[model samples]
Target: MKAIQIATYNKNIIRALLGLKTVEKSAGSPGDDEVLVKMHAAPCNPSDIAFIQGTYNIVKSLPAVPGFEGAGTVVETGKNTGHLLGKKVSAFVQRDTDGTWAEFFVVHRDDLIVLKDEMDPDQAACFTVNPFTAYGLMEIALLRESKAVVQNAAGGQVAAFVRLMAAENGMEVINIVRKKESVDVLRQAGARHVLYENDEDFEQQLRGLCAELQATTAFDAVGGPLAGTIFNSLVPDAELVIYGGLSGKPVENLDVMGPIFQNKIISGFNLIDWKNELDAEDFEKISGFLQDKFIGGTYKTKIQGSTTLDKIVKGLRGYIANMSAGKILIRP
Candidate 1:
């Protein structure tokens, strides 16, 4: 099978070599509890870039295929996993392995989440990461009775998911975006409040927005100087969850006095960590939320582009350029 590999990892000039014609390498026949899937589509996420650069938490061995989450059809299954054969499923696999970027991959039957036939393949490809992260952040930080929450990079797919989820829960969202145009994008997607990060009075405006919304929690994706600004705008005893560092800079120092004196809480989240900590019952609960949203037509994926496996490098470059509003997919 032809696939893409991280040909070189130069911090200054990272390169991916596409059209690597090669035979499929099988790890092993599916265990009794595992299923083999023929991958249909997988998204190129920021984490994929981090993996290639070796800056991500999970380091990849050189010449590895890289992708985090994806959806596919079951081709075969172990005896105990036989019920899953021919079903559509999504998975989160270990990095550097033959990930979703390949023609085929295997996952534990328990780890695979079944998807409905009505769901789009591209949307299903993205089901595991962004949506689940948004859902978990809200579940962990926002109490049911909380009025509102704030988030950075509000225009992103995950943030958009958060905004809609909040609205459905009867909670307001104060979504902050670096670009003015994103304000419109998020507002159309159900954000109750929007702030422009580039505004000269961004700090003042953010505080005013939080005050008006009475926001008690903030989800920060852009972790650099922007994180400090987000920290400053929280209500007393509010919680802030930092999950991404798209800014490529260290998170700014917060005024320690505010958190300590105001009794605010600061923490971080990594979806992989959260998933690892959850038992089967918890996974079912979270998966149920996503499933319900899909049935209700509340969870929609905006596909930026789709291409064949041979064009993987081009897809990665497109994502790196930030040229897509939604996800860039590779169909195998």
Candidate 2:
């Protein structure tokens, strides 16, 4: 089988270690509660980059495949999971086994999300990550009865989903982006409150928006000073949820007084943890709801391009260069 293999971790240059190799891998009958999938498309996410650099939360042995999520057809299913055989599915895997970057993937049945027939293979390739993450974040916002929310990395796919979901529920979004051009891009996308963090008055603008909307919740993907900035700007009793550390820095300049006197809180959101917190039935319900949105064209991941396994390294380099533009999918 042809797979994208990372021979070693390269923090400095990802392409230095990434390559396509033909290996003797068996897609044998899956074990109990597992299924074998013939992968169609897999995406290159920032987490994939982190994994290649050996900085992600989940790490596999050397010379391993690097993708975590993808869409494929179920070729075989284990006992009690035969219902999934021949079904089109989007899978998320974190086991020691090779991942979705290969032509074949073996994952536990629980990690697969059954895709609606109308869902395109490319969109389904990205189904398990950003969409669920946005759903989870909005779940928190809805639970808090927040009228509006703030989020960094406004140009990313998850942020785009968050904005759309918030709008559907009559909630506002204060989007913060590092690049000035992103402000215009998001605004044209119908975002009402987009802020350029590089601007001189970014802090003042954020504070005003948070107060005016009474936005008590914020989702932070870029940590470091931006996390603290968002944390301090929200109204009293607000919660700042940190999910990704794209900035590669720790949260800084957080005002202790807010937590000590103003009822402010800092938290984290992990998609795996969020999913695990729900019962199987509830998870299935949410999955159905999200899939309907995709099938209806209410939600979609922006796709920049697609690549073959042989060109994965080149594709990844392009993706890392302009990440906010769109996703790069690997057609394995």
Candidate 3:
């Protein structure tokens, strides 16, 4: 099989670490509840980089395929999966299985999200990670009855959906970005409260806005001190969900001590872990909800560029340099 495999982990240049090789492997046959999919497209995500660099929560062995999600057609299926044989589907690849970056993939039928025939392959290909994470975390915030939510790295791909959630529910968003230009980007997109971290009054503004809205939950992708800063801004008995460590720093070392005895709770939220908790029907329902948002141009994804199989190294490097540019898709 032709696939981009991670040969080893490079701590310094994690994004640019990969190799294109014609590995001798194949999905021989599906079990009674499995299906074989001929992959159409896959997106290059930060999680893929983390997994290949051996920095993700779950580590893959060396010489393994590295994509996490993609969309494709069910080429063949086991006896129980016969009804799904010709359907278009999106799936998440568990670390142990050969990932979705390849030409073909096989996974349990229950993991598949059957896509509507009119759906674009590109949208479905990149569906699992950002869309699911955004919706799942926002749902948590809504469940907690938060009046507003604050997020670090507000210009991120997944954070866009969070912005949409705020707009739809009339919930205020304390969006913090690093660059001045990003404020305009979100502001033009209907975001009323965008701030820059480099501002002299950044922390003071965050503390004020959070207090005004009485925000009880925060969705954090940028870890480190930023997480602690947001933690301190929330009201008492607030909850913080740290889902990504884009800062490449540890949560324990942050200076803020709000979570110590202020009734602030800090926890982690992984999309894959949340997916694992759902039954097949519930997973499909959530997928359908997101699909409706995408198809309606509400929760849309921006594609910076599409890369072929051999150009994955260049793609990863470009994405790492400018994550806010957009998602880079692998159209093999």
Pick the lDDT winner.
Answer: 2
Query: Which candidate has the top score in TM-score?
Result: 2
- Per-candidate clashes come to 0, 0, 0
| Candidate 1 C-alpha lDDT tens digits along 72-183 | 9999899898889899988887644556778887787656789877777777888888888988888865663568888887778888788777877788888888877777
Worst 10 contiguous positions by lDDT, candidate 1: 13-22
Every candidate's lDDT? 0.77, 0.89, 0.82
Collision pairs in model 1: none
lDDT tens per residue, model 2, 1-332: 67777777777654444444545566557988999999999998888887877778998988787789999999988887889999999999888778898898888988999888999889999999999999999999999999999999999999999998999899999999998898889888888899999899999999999999999999999999999999999999999999999988999989999999999999999999999999999999998999989889899999999888887778878888888899999997
- Give lDDT for model 2: 0.89
> How many residue-pair clashes does candidate 2 contain?
0
Once fitted onto the true fold, the runs of candidate 3 whose alpha carbons sit more than 4 angstroms away are 14-28, 252-257
lDDT (Cα, tens digit) per residue for candidate 3, span 92-206: 8774777888878887876778898777889899887788898889888889888899988888888888888777888888899988999998898777888898899888998
